[model samples]
Target: MRRPLRILQATALALCLLTTAAPASASAASSPAPSPPSAAEAGPVLAVPADLAAEEVSFRGGGGLAMRGTVLSPAKAPVEGGPGRPGIVLVHGSGAGVSRTKLREEAVAFARQGLSVLIYDKRSEGYSLFRRSYPQLADDALGAVAALRSRPGVDPAGVGIWGFSEGGWVAPIAASRSADIAFVVLVGANGMPPLRQQTWAVAAGLRKAGVSGSLVERAEPAMYRLIADGGLFPEPYHDPGPTLAAVRQPVLGVWGVHDLLTPPAENPPLVARALEKGGNRRYTFHFFPGADHAAHLSPDGGVTRLPELAPGYADLVGSWVRDVTAGRTPVAGTSGPAPVQDSATVPMGPAARWESAPVQLAALVLFAVAFAAYPLVALVRRLRGRSRRPVTRAARLLAATGAAAVLGLFCYLFYVLTTGAKLAAPGPVAAGRPLIWLALQVLAVTCVAATVLTASAWYRSRGSADPARPGERGERVRLGLLLAGGAVFVPWALYWGLLLP
Candidate 1:
């Protein structure tokens, strides 16, 4: 009996082990497989044509940002007689974001013409993260140059940076820090101090919109004060001249004759002169006649209807960029054909020229005056009338003032919206009109709401109703006023300013 029992126990233990082990083995086999590698990790380097393939490369920069750019050899395939290609890095202008499409287009154009090109996004723009500081961007650009030098296709000794607008400013600073950068191309750059640049940008914008010479003259001091004090007049003033003069690099400056943002009178030549004064001989300047900023491309590039000017302007830039990269001198003169007779002849009178300045000034002054005077006037009337009336009068006065403010705000917003629409035609005056109008509308609505709510509460407390049960009817009326005011302000402002612009 004991032997039989032992046999059965041993069999049962073996059976239990098999049951548990079988499920475990099956689970191991049935589990999901691991995922494939991501695109960034795989690092698939794109191939160029057989002749151009020698220049193609992928490199990693110091900021932990991987940059992918192309190298273009001077000859088709392997050639015996041709010189090696020079290298150029194309930097983009400021816009909604760093333009990868623009950069690629520029690189390909230069590459086809026998040059190696590296164009990458600024940190926080394009494929990179957003909101990176200027210093970080400069560092990334520096890193790109270092990476290019290590690559097989690039001529480490011959590297340059071609920058536009903000890029122009950044290139000099970066070049100063790195010896690798051999030259710089600055499109629509200015030599004046930054404060002066700011003032000039504003003044030029005004002049383009048809502002009077006298007003511009009068406004200059205030504009200077605004920049000097860092907004409106304050105490210490900051100057930006010395910083600009510190840049030591070969520069090529380009500007548009009708560039309202940085007027020709205030920009290109001025920048060239600054460099010249610094005893820098390696400089070239070019200005496009009758061309608005970024509008003139290849002399025959037609007026583009795109909202942003980057696309229409990219080709001309690519052409010049090709020359710079190929170690050829850039021709400094007008490009593309003149505009059509009708388009070229559109008259820009005085009113159209300086429209931005006066409109902006008027709106600012109105807001300031309204905010300051209304409260003081209301207080004075309340105190003077207190001798003959009950204390409740103060509360009523406050409510009345609040109501008036709301009314004024409604009027201001209405004017901004309607006038903004009227100003939106494709002319000099309307260029910055939309931004100005929107700011004014925001100020008006904010001021009215703040004053009305604060003042009405003060007035209601002064009334002779029960301390705990002050008039619900009056409170509701005031609440209704606030709501009604917003309802009137929003739609009207949008319809006038946005739709019109």
Candidate 2:
């Protein structure tokens, strides 16, 4: 169908920086467009090649869920019961609510190029009211392949899958499951473990949005620990290298230089190495400069896109697929030598490992304990029934500051996950406005002030003739631990990209 190409969803998937231009409404969030048109009719309404026809179809998806699929076919076809034309199945990214309406243009685009295209609603849509899992989504794509093969104009021997973003991970496994998969196209595929990629992207986004490099650097160990300590993924992070290495089909990996969601610096190399090791000489990898995750960039830095797909991108994908089906050597995806790569590019590697996990665990634990120091001291005083002592106003303020910093640290982590992870920025949004970043600043100031006061308290306590409840020795030890906790808070604050100074 000739239609507009537009997708509005959460950009938290953008690799780095905690920034995203917020969407219009909660209804328009990354989930599929709400109240999508049903698989109502049996025919497509969009314009396609004069010799092709379009129709809405449904098939059994993963777990026997009823999935809605749109099939585009050649109007003039080989005789019935004969082998048909090469087919391509378009798999969606992480959009759980992806619908037929959102995919008609893409399906028509490929069909116009003389290939049968099957665009289907993801498993999250119709049947199997279960939470989405990779195994199931891969099964859904495989099911689409089966559904396509069942069609009159689809060639079973020439069928393949093309996926983007999360699809990058799903498509490979679908291809690996059966040798029947003739080829694969991965758009912005991820090379590292899924969670690591996500965390790195979060950190990278923070660094891009005015966060200090030093703070970003210091946060890695704790971020790494978040992964190894579990709760990050349904399973241990999925290392895509092994799965990509197992694919024997002809493959094409497409990426963009400016794709924050999938770092172009890393994904291209990782896919190249894995495909090479798998002995898949049929694999071709292409990188486009100045494009975002979708192979196009917004000049004004807003999501408003150019009417056309990125320069040479649509042609690159269409032409490559045609070549694959035609038994010709696929184009290298560029006329001249590749564009020069960025010098600051970072590669994809394991983020947290067993060796590092222990140290991170200890640091995180002590920090949490340190976070409790203020409370612990108060509780001690309460139980001992100590009368109020004449501590300096500076000491009282400093102690309270220490407690507040601890509380702020806990609040800060929650803030990142709640705001950045689920919503837009890591700040409160009022009247659709993202409040300025102040949480980190508050924590940082508190940490600095706490450090000085704790030290000063320690200095004065050491020389006191009459120590209060804890006495000199006990008071000295408590003060020292408080100082140590404050010291740890400084780095932890920096790690969150809080106060850079």
Candidate 3:
């Protein structure tokens, strides 16, 4: 429930942001007439170095979208009859939608390590949102693959992809689609099914914000369903297992032991199991002790300055490319201990993508209709000049209490979805917390009171039933409203873990 609500609120936020950003985006695209990049214009490392060559390049994606990036290759020409210089295309992470320049650090570092690397702008940056489907993203990646393989010194047989975060999911599927891909490097990848991974991510986030573990567990499924309907990323039905198994190439998995962004702790083992089960013999997994998502960290995790790209992170990946392409067997790490978990069997099952979207949408519809009924009825009565109902005081209180309770729960949901993630970062829930934890604390109390009050009214009204009642229609409507609102509010309250300690 929390995750889905977060996504919904976030989508609304993105649309709002896009409206403001549209003009800037248009201006940038239309006004762009910069000269082609020269050696000096390229950054320090990317400049024409003695050992490296950088080229401004572009490739046609699905529907001929011109995705652009820089391809960096070793200046040393490939030796004839020797293994072609190994190469890799950089697959974008979730935020890869930012811009091509966002990947400069990774590209330059890999280029320095002596591998041909392609870092391209993600299609999502300029393409229509609806057109950026899984296959289309994969197609864009494959386009880069083709471009990289065609590079002057790149070995067509040794070129593959290095994917981070969501790219992890996209890269494997792209690789399995063709034998052209030689190997895969998955960094900060989640081995969990997409939906499960997202749900777990939301749950962990809540826990970090001081949400209790038990409540997080309770709220996870409802949140999963919410995500199914309208989450940011269209949940793909990609089961990474079969695809991971299908890859005949040696694979390397990198993770940070303390990573919460993608929860690397769980996924590395999952990746290994599936690969081994699928008959993939050469697999290497490495864990870093003190890194977060994006593989960046500080000595004590305080906020750091720009270019916090993890030390030696890119080098590890670059080294893997060096070893695999040099005809040496894949090593566990560039210089770390062997993989903690050896190969094992991973249970294969259907992905949780959209499994609960329909039912969750049904619940939202029910709540919406029920929430609107009373106000619409009151407006009609006012316009028609109907007299006020002579309902008993108890029934009126029930209606009031129920409405208040529903209002509280709805507000809390809105608050969490809007501000929880940002506010959760520094530490414990603070006084200036956006959710107004006190309001939620008050909401929890009022909801309990409403539940008790409504139940009491319901029981007492039955005993006082009068078939000849004058305000029978209005009274019945109000009673139904109270019951309906309570029905919606109670479960929502419970699902959000609002009633928990």
Candidate 4:
């Protein structure tokens, strides 16, 4: 009688806890493009002169939102009715607080070359960490273009757009949609999808910080894909291929030879190919040595940033824009030294439907419940004074280690990614693996071994079990859960690089 009753109570307790556990899971703006000369032959850094006139202005941007900005032009205003100067509207990179001020130095540099420059506050309405509309950003750029073109001192027909970093994606889209934009200037632009670029960037940062092993080779990219599949990453799969193909205007794409964010060696050829595919050949590519992603000075291969723009960067843009806007567009050419890439980009595709967010959440809940049931069932029997078969030491080790390994991997990965890979401080590393990661791998192995020993113990005890004993069935059920958790742990560990070499 007590045997059946104990079975019923344990089953009911498992159901209640299972039900409860299931629901528990929840860019720099500015200096971009072109060089006065090859990096080795580069001349003195051109000083940004302050002899520019900046006027406060406002314009209507995308989504009918009012945007405010400043127009930096020659200190000596153009004579009334005189031929207007060429114009360039600066589109900001991705971020909420990026304002006109952020690009003021670049604008001042452009204005000093006798061009009209418009730098505006990026729209906050339809932009954020998890949300953004590139088309909408392009519209806002067109708005700035219109505002700058309307000024009496600017040449409406000569107006073009300059985009850096995130703006690289937005600028081409704007140029593709608007015939009014005369030429396009991109700095530190990415030709791949946002997800791939991000994954590469994080991995590069990790490597730069002295991290190696599977962290860079495998887990880093895999985690990014998983995050993207869960919809937490904004525009993770946004492809620049079609947008670049649609651009009809002349393009000047530039990158720092030391750029860490975008793959300099890889992007230029891709951008050039895309432009040529669309029957447009007025493109020029340049690389700047000792420059970071933003074309800013970075002496240490893009690991650190300096306030000054790379030598000759602004002068190159000023000259290139003037030439292209004046119908002197280059047929097609690449200049400067070759870029250095420490590693090849990892291929990333969309996660399968079976591996999507909801399914992942369900898996987590199942693993948690199954492993937890062992110790929990033991505690319940002890409190209720219910006699139960003794849980072998192997089964106890399996339950504790399996649960710890899964939870540790999840938490550690989250910490590494959220804090920008190695930037947020990924403890100490030994033999290229973080200390915490090494510990988790050990736990994963322990789980596997414990699973085997626990199974052996269970087999030996099954022969000794009395079906008629009150607590016999309940003890077997608990052991079964621990074994089930171990079964799932092996594949989970392998998937996340735990069991990988």
**Top of the candidates by lDDT:** 4
- Compared with the true structure, what per-residue lDDT tens digits does model 4 show for residues 1-501? 334334433433343332211111011223232222332342222234558776666777776666777788887877788667899999887777475778877888788888999888787665666567888899999988998999878989999999998999999999999999999999999888888888888887777667787777777777777667665577888888889999999999989988888888888888888888888899989999888888889877787878888889889898998888778868799988889888778767898766555555556666788889888888887899874655478888888898898777767776676556225367787777788888988999999999999888888877777799776776777778778878888877787788875
- Which tens-of-lDDT digit does each residue in 332-372 have in candidate 1? 34333332211111111122222333433333344334334
What lDDT is obtained when candidate 1 is compared to the true structure? 0.45
lDDT of 3 by residue, 359-455 (tens): 4444555544554565566568789897564334443444444455444544444344433321233224444232444455455556456556656
Q: Which residues of candidate 2, in runs, are more than 4 Å off?
A: 1-52, 74-82, 125-132, 224-230, 233-236, 288-290, 300-307, 329-387, 406-501
Estimate every model's Cα lDDT from 0 to 1.
0.45, 0.61, 0.61, 0.78
Q: Kindly provide the TM-score of model 4 when superposed on the true structure, using C-alpha atoms.
A: 0.87
The regions of model 3 sitting more than 4 angstroms off are: 1-51, 75-84, 125-132, 213-215, 230-233, 300-308, 331-411, 414-471
Ordered by TM-score, highest first, the candidates read 4, 3, 2, 1
lDDT of 3 at 15: 35
Model 4 lDDT vs. the true structure? 0.78
C-alpha positional error of residue 296 in candidate 3 after TM-score superposition, expressed in Å: 3.0
Weakest 10 consecutive residues, lDDT, candidate 3? 339-348
RMSD of each: 20.0, 9.4, 6.5, 10.3
Candidate with top TM-score is 4
lDDT of prediction 3: 0.61
| Model 4 spans > 4 angstroms off | 1-50, 387-389, 421-424
Task: Give residue 282's error in model 1 in angstroms.
Answer: 1.6
Error of 1 at 182 (Å): 1.5
Each model's TM-score?
0.51, 0.70, 0.75, 0.87
